[model samples]
Target: MDSSIPSISPWRLSVAPMMDWTDRHCRYFHRLLTQHTLLYTEMVTTGALRHGSVERHLRFNAEEHPVALQLGGSDAADLAFAAKLGEQWGYNEINLNCGCPSDRVQRGAFGACLMNEPPLVADGVKAMVDVVSVPVTVKHRIGIDQIESYDFVRDFVGTVKDAGCSVFIVHARNAWLQGLSPKENREIPPLRYELAYQLKKDFPSLTIAINGGITRNDQIAEHLNEVDGVMIGREAYYNPWLLTTWDAQFFNSAESSITREAVEEAMVTYMERAFKEDGCPWYAIARHMLGLYHGQRGGRLWRQVWSNHKLKPMQPREVMAVARVALAKGAEVPA
Candidate 1:
């Protein structure tokens, strides 16, 4: 029997949900770079949202629209309740996190371990979809542990798709749940993009966005030819300037990429406002902007000035002024 292909959504480019990295502050920062690229929150467990301060976990800036909330849990009821909260919080989509391989997440019986139990994942997806008006998606690995069979992921996708998940972000690597640390899982496993492409071919109706080790604009361009979308992780954070070009490069946007100076200015304004309204420390915002200069001339000096802990007490505008001066001096950076 031919599987009915689902209608794909507008998910051409997305930033992967990095724990501790892609928080609300990071998402707001990313929104300044590319208006078209979708941003995701760090995985918020159902426990945190339900038992802890719900507002703190679910709150987000209005500017971070088209953003998705990635939820981590195995319980169908918890996931459904969390999805409902995400909808209430104005998230464009609700994403199930079946990709993380951290030991902490494993203890909860969710994350990559859920990949081994397709029925449970399916139930969670169905429950979330039934209650939430927004789309429910899943991010997962190509395989789990020592399992290398393509059929493992193929069946996983089939089962969850039946439960109403049409969009999938597939990290093109097997998650070694036991021996490797979370960081090692990202680096050690060889990326098998072909597996992702093949999955797209087999499940022609599903929206398959390839993740894992994709670092360049050309790579994103190339993947879009075969799959429905592309999701970038470390590269998007460590060197976020890459995202500035995505709006024009992939979305045919006529607006040129915003100047680095403009981005810095906007962030400074945000920092000032946040501090006044919420008492946010300047360095908390500055840490995310250290890579804004990236490869530009005097970029290192500018980064150093912004990240200098001594300036933590200084206002964000003063830090911005110092960074601008450093860039103006154009000090030679070591190769």
Candidate 2:
């Protein structure tokens, strides 16, 4: 471990920085599920901040506490400046996105491609650390393309660690930079949990969190023994109920998990308030929660009622009433 590395930050459970999905409203809804699980914003590129309005890219609710701002860029100066803006906007941590395999991100000269250039990443991390008081972190893939050696990721971590970044979120899969879409890269590459576990063994001083393909609570429990934390992506968004149980199960939290009905009602209230406050549409918030009823009997019909375009003219409370009536008629609950 490099002497310059900062102290490890506790990240027992977190959500991945999904591009279009994890926005401010999505995060506020997720916070209702489990208060303990850390949440991240979608990756904000340096160009968006350097040239555009910083507040538009960084605005977040205070309730989304322990939230992190993930930056996408290859330039050290731009990243550091963006990180400073994030801190000023009240983010808890600053994370660099080096694991994203998207073509747009690739063209920007950041994301997974940076894995092939460690020195540049080190300089960027150091610059961000120098400008902010918050902990600077990195989220990256296990390897890139045909590079299968474990040394590839190990060496990347070692180099970045020298720049005062001690916390790493490793998506345990190789990022196929070319000939693979971002969605394919997430699924095609086989997960090697051992590689992340070995990272902890080799760099005991740094905090390591394993991401990719981890969906269940049992899997989260299993990985906790090997690394400092676990990060969930699609599953947490698709089946958000999975997160309701996370706090009590993983954090030894006494906070009882809220019922699905309660969550729906809370969201309905939120939708009404958001409409009055910001004129936000009801469906925008409801769309993120379609999976709330997940495995129940009439969950599909319930979701359909909420998503119906004809109902868009109705208020969220009216939509909620219709959805409840549909669920009641269908007996959505399992016997």
Candidate 3:
């Protein structure tokens, strides 16, 4: 092991960063569930950092440590500066986004499109690596469009690795760059986990983490056997309780004793404090936690009370009380 490397792999288990999700509040909520699992910010474009408010984009709760900042851009200079900002703002790692196939990203000449230009991606990675001491990683698909040749992705990893990126978070699926909406791209692409495994085998010195269609803990365990880590995507957001078991199962820590109710209470306290300090509304925070009781009895009713627009004017504690009452009774919202 390198002297710089930690005793435990920081990439061991993580939540994949998703746009429109995985914001500061979401990361904070996840922190309450598992202390050790790595969290990532949604893809922050270099242009945004160059022209936008830095605080609004980089601000995060201190508890979200071991959290990574994922940047979406191809310009080496912009990436280097954005990565420096991320490190200065306390992000634990800097990740390059190479697997997103959205049209917007394409227009910006990055994301999954970057896969077509390995040298360019390498430049960006090396630029960031030179500026930040934190580990630089890349999250990308196995292939792009109809090109399924293993060599396409193989060469990509080889080139980027040379540029000082040692960790690769493989999405385990081809990114259909055309004709597929982002949602469709996520599901329609066939997952070939073997490609990710092969990347680990071919580059044994590198840390390879697998992602895509990995929802169950057993699946995470199975992948971990083949790779260095496992990253859960939308599943972690929709079924957050799944995170409650990660520490005990993956990190060999004690089992979590917190229950669904307790987590909700904690969120209520956080919501009040957030509003008091930042004027952020409870509903804004509440939206991220609506899935806290997912698959539990009366969960829909609980979500209903919390998501109800009429409750916007009420205090978060009051809303939590109403939600708990509705959850226990399993009845419709009061008129």
The candidate that wins on TM-score is 3
Per-residue C-alpha lDDT of model 3 across residues 206-298, encoded as one tens digit per residue: 999999999999899899889999999999999999999999998878999988888898899989889888899999999999999898777
Using lDDT, rank the candidates from best to worst: 3, 2, 1
Model 3 CA deviation exceeding 4 Å by range: 1-6, 331-335
Clashing pairs in 3: none
Error of 1 at 56 (Å): 0.9
Q: Which lDDT value does model 2 have at 257?
A: 54
Off by over 4 Å in 1: 1-9, 332-335
Kindly report which residue pairs in candidate 1 clash with one another: none
Query: For candidate 2, lDDT tens digit of each residue in 206-237?
Result: 99999999989899999999999999999999
TM-score on alpha carbons, each prediction: 0.95, 0.95, 0.96
Q: Among all windows of ten consecutive residues in candidate 2, which has the lowest summed lDDT?
A: 1-10
Greater TM-score among 1 and 3 belongs to: 3
Q: Write the per-residue lDDT of candidate 1 for residues 54-171, one digit (tens) a residue.
A: 9889898999988999999999999999999999989999999999999999999999999999999999999999999988999999999889999999999999999999999999
